[model samples]
Target: MTTTGTTSKQREQATRKTGSQSGQPIVAGVRSDLHTMLLPMFAEQNEIHDLETVIDGCRIRIRSHDAGVRIPTFMDQKIMMLLAAHIRDVIQSGGQPTRHINIDRREVIDLIGGGGSTGGSDYRRVTERLQRLHSTKITAETAISADVSRRRHFSWIDAFEEDILHTDKGKEVIGLKISLSVDAFRWITQGDGFDMTRERFKSITSAQSSCSRIYAICLANLIYAKGEDVYIQIEDLRLRVPSADTLKGFKKRPLSKAIELISASPDMSRYLSVSLVRKTEDGFIPLDGRAPLESVYIRVCKGPDALPSINKLLPLSETGGDTRSLSAAESLVELLTDRGSSAFTDTEMADMS
Candidate 1:
């Protein structure tokens, strides 16, 4: 867990160039299922004690280590993405992939844009986030067979061992040997995932607030979307994000603020366009004071700088003969359509936030 001092050769090995450090397009493999369902939108440290809910007919239960720790937030999502990218690189290089992987702590901080300082405060925070990811447990319902249902229980990480290096300056964490839980490993390495550029991942993780980060994550996951416009009901979105904000508050603040941020980013705007819309008897219309806000209309297409790897991530044939790729929004629409309902009851809405 700790080392007295690192030799020059050791330091060189530790800092050797991975795909990310080489300035190549870092393509991160991310679980669409987990990202679209498990992560919370709000970054507030709210302790979740055996919280259980049903999302899209799948029962999900979340439990933190104790009242002192919270479930994985947007920040942890960034860490998971980084780990996924590392694992992908390992597999592509013909290295045997496993649930356990090694990571350089300093390189991680630099990649996620945490801060320039790798001092005690920063290291402590990073370790705390890792512990939180390891301690929080989740059980989700899955269908094992045509008529059989099963519940899978797992955590983001099973455990981690830290490598502390001692220098004349001070003691520092040089690396980590992290073991991903069974479900987490399967989710990341399996074919049911998406690819994202390293720059986009960093841009989102370093976002100023939870709302902005969550919005960026949602948009980035829409890389596979094949339509000109995709409509998502606001109520359904609120539940998917598991946001604490009510419909009015969510629309006025987080949703609106995210739109503004995305619009201001020239690169982001070129790839994805987002706007508010209202539903009426005729069809979907632009948001105005006249009608109530009902849904968000999203248009996602490959920009000039988009990597070719994105197009190959999800093929229509893989999606069970569906002509268009099923983005998170499209998937939610299908679930809602099957249920014949989109609005949540007052009690259900209150419980979600």
Candidate 2:
């Protein structure tokens, strides 16, 4: 299906660029600035799955569309990630944020580390991912304006067109043209949604751990704090990050290990400092110390100026308990999940001090 009501790809002179540069920025198509309004795309091992998560009264839902009764409906996170990388590049490259945009297939393959894979296989995978992105539906219901709750329903991309080359060996993908849906475009255009730094985002491209990338995305939308920190239940975090382990297995090592990796990463440390912790009857304890594992907390430190400013965002206090009405972590969630905008409600801001 073709897109309507907006501009598509304005053909540019195809510039030949080769190879991946380490630490170069990759723009993810579905970035909500640093706020995680959209659910994660996939876990480890390239699993195709469906998931739903709700914060406050808002729901971020993703599901696949399948006509065949025999085929299960799910969105592959790898496809979404690859497509996000391409879309990010296009927008950063000065292309218009219309539904339609063109990218070289080889560039996508290179971006996703498809080296050594056969051309036919690469082409097949890219085609399948595009189809999934086009077919999958995403629905988000949250406050888009003061006093009015809006429900946004749209696909990542409305429709796609590809350039194909047939040779004696097999069919090869030459290029792709895709259109961003109306709702998706609005989300990108609204507020400070696309305000992430390219350097911080590019760090994900070179990092060895996928969880580190997830940590960075989560950090982008976080409320800055000195000591008072943000927390997520281990199970809640497991759902947000893609992993190969079962929920039970993920808790044992992978989750903690991922947080440790982020702590040690220099590229990631530039933006924020993170540690895995658990809250106890006594108080919140760092997992690195001799704390018992119960509720897992991902503690995010104050990030760089590249992130949204404290003046415009909800304040997370450095101290907690009876001294403050709301803990920093609780306030952070309210900032993220309340009105689709990152700022707090008037009453909420009044309660902060």
Candidate 3:
């Protein structure tokens, strides 16, 4: 029937969920049927478009709404690949992933929590070291103006009356300004996208060093996805993360709930901002944080899919078997689900130590 909230073009921007019959995949949406049937009994249950041959083998039905999921732009996806590659490299080198690092900036700031008590001493020292390694400073400014340019024109004024005639006015909606933040991390460099973080660490001697190494690597990636620039204010700085913690085995609470509990404490929330973002077929892009317009400094984008029913998010392999192909949705899900926790959180620092 009728869909609301999006223009025709915007609605059309929504992606198709059905597959073509290539005879290779088990998921029907990826394949096309030799004989096509067009009628009522087409799509899978609770979906708007079946996007496949009405068959029993492989199938997918995508819900059609006036608006569908919006994805990260090309540059962001490139950036995501950079982040993912760096993360994978670190983990492969025997380092703990970012998820495994448990110190918030505050505990990091005050030097208290190392995510738990078991490894507290190790976490405390290592985190302090990492803090010194990746320190950076940033400043951003937003400008406004009332002038029009060659590519822009002022609109004609209408409905002027003698009783209320006055001078017509025009204004600039947004002006370009610069945000100055150091390069704490680089996603793409010199025709290659991987292994740009070697300089951020001091030589990791063991698993402990590796854990801290990966933690810094994770934060470097996390900082970029939030639309913030990562940089090293102090050169030769290193981020230290302890290799051990007792809470590593605990089942995770809902990510949103964790962010809430963290942010609910005014002091704790001040450590970092949290949000849930989506991973696309190409790469992971962060969702924005929830903050008032005037008060936030550094924003941390955290959590998994901002969308519901991630299980249904398109996978590189619609059949849930193999993923040799590229499906943007599938790509994203794999990235965010890598550690099971879907969010990335960081802080607006007073200054990196």
Highest TM-score: which candidate? Answer: 1
TM-score-superior candidate, 1 or 2: 1
Model 3, span 1-353: residue lDDT tens: 76544343432332121121111211111111101101111111221221222111112122222233121111111222223333344445666433111112222222212234434355344333332222211111111235521111111011111111112232211111111111211111111122322211112211232222322333333433443432221111111111122222111222233445445533323323444333333333454544232221222433332211111112223233223322332232223222212222223222321
In the predicted model 2, the residue pairs found to clash are 33-193, 34-221, 43-242, 43-243, 44-243, 99-179, 99-180, 100-179
Judge candidate 2 against the unseen true structure and give its global Cα lDDT, from 0 to 1: 0.48
- 69-95: candidate 2 lDDT, tens digit per residue: 111122233333344445455556776
Q: What is the lDDT of candidate 3?
A: 0.24
User: Model 3, 99: alpha-carbon shift in Å?
Assistant: 29
On a 0 to 100 scale, what is the lDDT of residue 32 in model 1? 35
RMSD of 1: 8.6
What does candidate 1 score on TM? 0.71
Clash number for every model? 1, 8, 32
Ranking by TM-score: 1, 2, 3
Candidate 1: give the clashing pairs: 244-353
Q: CA lDDT of 198 in candidate 2?
A: 36
lDDT per residue for candidate 1 within 1-353, as digits (tens), equals: 75556676555555453211322343443323334332342233345445665665766677787568777665666677677777767766877667787776665566655446666676677787787788788766645469987565667888988765557666756557788875566556543445555565456445555445445434533432332244456655555566667877877776777777776776566566566766555455677664554544322334444422332222334324223323422443233223224432223334455
Model 1, global lDDT: 0.55
Clashes of 1: 1
- Each prediction's whole-model lDDT (CA): 0.55, 0.48, 0.24
